[model samples]
Target: MRATSRFLLIGLASLALAAPVSGQRSDDQILPKSAELQKQGRALYSAGKLTEAEDLFETALAVDPRNRGAFVDLARVAEKQHLFGKAIRMTNKALQLEPNDADAIAIQGEAMVELGAVARAQQNLQKLQTICRQGCPQVAQLSAAITRGPTVASAKTPETPKTN
Candidate 1:
């Protein structure tokens, strides 16, 4: 995760840690009101509400189909659920919309790696580094992972968030 997303995850972790979690996020980036739904989805995801989070993410996407963030997040949740095929499809949707989005590309790479398509995974991860944001370190980690190949060890944490 990037610093911002990591910070968000830390917040989420505090939320989840008290209960139980886990991203890269942008700073100085103002997401639209549609983020409310995304926030709900993340909270639900942290809460171990995979199905619910999936539904909320779907709803968020419906409300803003162009929101690549939701697609990437949804794909991640699906990946955690061991729904590799679904993850692939969802990430594909994100990639289709934001072909050059570094986060989306990096996530797609991770998904591809999970789906056993190492080449494709490497391709996407490389793209992420090539288009990385300033001061974000998750991109490096992701790129490193791609270079290192699959981990086979899941680092998935809990999905309720800590109250903000």
Candidate 2:
């Protein structure tokens, strides 16, 4: 009876470990409510209501943290806010969900460019090229951003007055 109980305990433990793996959602399985929230967020973003859009995007993520589109949209909002580092981090989350996401790579590249990380942006561009060999709008967008270079505000530093 002792040996049987031990075997049953081990089996239950293994099954518990596997339960989470089974519960994990696939990349294609975004929650519908999250998608709806993301749609609303996109409309708000397009209408120049960035704060409202950000709120909706955050809600979408709360509903479904795996909503890769929401992550990408949040990154766009961050870029608009001139929060380049946050934008990069948001795109990194989307990339984690789908490594071949051209939009995420492009957005991340643009944010990197804004931060004056040209070399890293170039690498992201290369990755986009590899992922979209047939050519894509993201490729063009990222290329244009690279050509534009970093914003003047990002490049400039305030000068301090020298004390006698």
Error of 1 at 139 (Å): 2.6
Tens-place lDDT per residue, model 1, 1-164, is 48999899889878876652124334224256657898999999999989999888888888777677888889889778767677778878877876776666666667677666888877766666667646356577566767766555455555768796
- Alpha-carbon TM-score of each model against the true structure: 0.64, 0.84
Candidate 1 off by > 4 Å: 1-33, 133-135, 151-164
Candidate 2: 10-residue stretch with minimal lDDT: 147-156
Window of ten residues with lowest summed lDDT in model 1: 20-29
Q: List, residue by residue over 1-164, the lDDT tens digit for candidate 2.
A: 99999999999999999998997878789899999999999999999999999999999999999999999999999999999999999999999999999999999999999888999999999999999999999999999999999985656899999999
Clash pairs (backbone) in predicted model 2:
none
User: What is the lDDT, from 0 to 100, of the residue 126 in candidate 2?
Assistant: 94
Q: lDDT for every model?
A: 0.73, 0.94
- List where candidate 2 sits over 4 angstroms from the true fold: 1-16, 154-164
User: What RMSD, rounded to one decimal, does every model reach?
Assistant: 20.5, 3.2
